[model samples]
Target: MKKPVAGDSPASSLSPCEIPKSLLPIFLKHIAAFIDSLNVVVLARLLPQSHHRRILTASTSAVAASLLSQRQHRLVLAISTPLLQPPAASTRPLLPPDNGIKKNVQGPTFMRKIWARDKQEAIQVEFNDLGQPIDEKSSSELAHFLGAIARNGRYAPLHYKNWIKVPQTYKKEMLTQVQEKFQLPPGQEDWILKSITKKWRNWKSFVKTNYYDPNVSLVEQMKNVPERVHEDQWKELVTFWNSDASKRVSDRNKVSRGHQKMVHRKGKMSFARVAEKKKKELGYYPSRSTLFIECYSKGETPGNEVASQAMVQNRVCLKSINDPTQIVAKGIVRSIDPSTEVGGSRLRPNWCEVHIQVAVEWDEELIRRYGMFETIGDALGAHVAWPLFLVERDESDD
Candidate 1:
């Protein structure tokens, strides 16, 4: 067989129906290659037949073509090119027949029947529109279905393999339960169950893989994001995991999504119970943080007040965050050399208490005990508050 010249109609030169079954795949492959090579303009010029135009419009639409990436759209248009040509002059009637059909009919009226028959053939052509898969159900139906499932608060159910293996009677029973819970449409139970199960498996896999480090601070971890996904997409995914939806889903499934878990404390507890008990017996009451407000004493106040205001001094211990009423020290604050190294770590904030003494300043104590020292310092070392603590005027009439 001779190779068809460029611009020649392959369908007109060779019979599409008469092609040998063994050679059909090879022939289709050649056709596909030829179509892929042609540009949109060439394709538009080639497929002048009305039925071909309709097929192009129905399947590989202009909207679909435009949605695809430049390279993909070009291929879409090329594949839409027509296969056959207009009928020959010889095939036309020599004289007017009793038949009512007109002589000047459009391209290949005889081939129109063949085109209709080819439509039934098991030829699968797909066009990527860069859109979600076509949904047989309406948007409203889908939304309603999803809303029903969400109301139940049950997500990420069992696998599809398990779902498929269950006996038809059991499947029906499960579907009935789902239907009652979700208030789904009567006949849609099976579809809803399958959709829910498949989606649950997918969601489970996604959450399982994407759960970031629980140990690392979220703020620090965000500095170096994953490279696999787009920046915006990664941010969105992070936001989603941080959202209540992720929490609810994880809680329902008893799975950890790597988010920070909140611990609930019923009451405040001291760091050293026995020591605190002994101190309490010694007439040392827990000093409330709110009561020990950093107050401006009108005139030149002590170095401690100045240091506290500057956030260079922290009198309260580590346990103070939970119970600010614990461990209160009273002393005058003074600026220190931050450059001076202390145990291989610099005194970063450069503020310390001078004249060195811990005074029992709270009025609640019946006995005021004072500790005399050369240079009093917090054994816990420098602690700075990122969020500035509240300071108020001493408000004394004096």
Candidate 2:
């Protein structure tokens, strides 16, 4: 009689006592192999049909050969086709359902450790005058001192345009604090104060521009800003930018004729260009009208505060300096910046300046009827590019 393979039923109607005990182990082994083959088929079915069929066929043939005691057949089946093989790594889902909970618990911790390592490399950890690490306490104390000086105004030089360039008094005060508190030598104290000042200003500038939340504390903001640059490291970067090799490259680029002139076209040419061309053909140059006034100064009138407030609201009226009643043109205040030194060695006003973008409009019928220059020259292109230059006036201004 042929020996029954794994998982085969006993053909004879017999009890367990009737079966040979020696065959029990073989029966169990075959049963386990049969179950494993079933599992392989079930998992392989998750793959594409062709892959699933190939894996199933190879696995079943190998199992059958093993049960039949055909070693050569089993080896051939295993070697010829990758039967009973694990699924492709690419095919396997990265986030398996069984591991989802474990991944959720551990993923953030792993990422945090990685980010911390990267940050440590990027930041220059600061040290106090006495070679102690300047921690949160030191930064807070420095901020308080700086804030006090700013409130006092005279020693702080907060009113100065170049306020960030630490004044002598500010430096002296910082040095005194560092010497008394940190107990370092005068030179070391000076160094620490300078480094801290640079760090503070850099942090403040970033916080002012980026962090819009008014409720956020300054301490928190400073903590979140990037670490202070070491003096030596900053010098390295400066040297690189100002290197002789860099200068030579810049000079060569300036002399090179290979660069193309880039014309930025926002839209079609302005109507003024067409009108101007038409006038030129008729042997007439277009009449000039002061249609726009960009920068206007009302010299130190009604104090800086009042002037700035008015400018912000766009309340200032701009009429012709020559003939105010003529209403040659009007200006809508676009922005106002505190007056800084301009004209590079010529005279400069200390007062704030109103920066206005002009309001110019031309009736299409009027322009066509006049057959001439009712509007100004195209700022963007040859055509009267009014849309590009013109900004809608505020309803209140109207």
Write one digit per residue (lDDT tens) for candidate 1, span 1-398.
77788998967678667678999899888876565444334445444343245435533234223323333445544555553222121111222364786666332112222223332342221111321112223322343343334222223222222345435664455454443333333355545565556544554354335444445565644543442223343455555555677768768766553321212121222122322343457676334331122121112222233234432232322112233334333322333455534334443432222222342332222111133211123322232221112211112311
- lDDT of each candidate versus the true structure: 0.36, 0.36
For residues 1-398, write the lDDT of model 2, one tens digit per residue: 35557776766434666558899899888877776666454444333343454555654543333222123334444544444433222111222357436554321011222123332243232443344334444443433443333333333332232345656777677555434433333345644554555545444343233432335543343333211222233333334334577458657856773432212231222223333444557576443221111112224332222233344436333333233222222344433333332122211322222233343332221111112434422211111111111222233565
Question: Against the true structure, what is every candidate's RMSD?
Answer: 26.5, 26.8
Cα deviation of 299, candidate 2, in Å: 43
Find the 10 residues in a row with the least total lDDT in model 2: 380-389
Which 10 successive residues of model 1 have the least lDDT summed?
A: 385-394
lDDT of 1 at 365: 27
Deviation from truth (RMSD, Å), model 1: 26.5
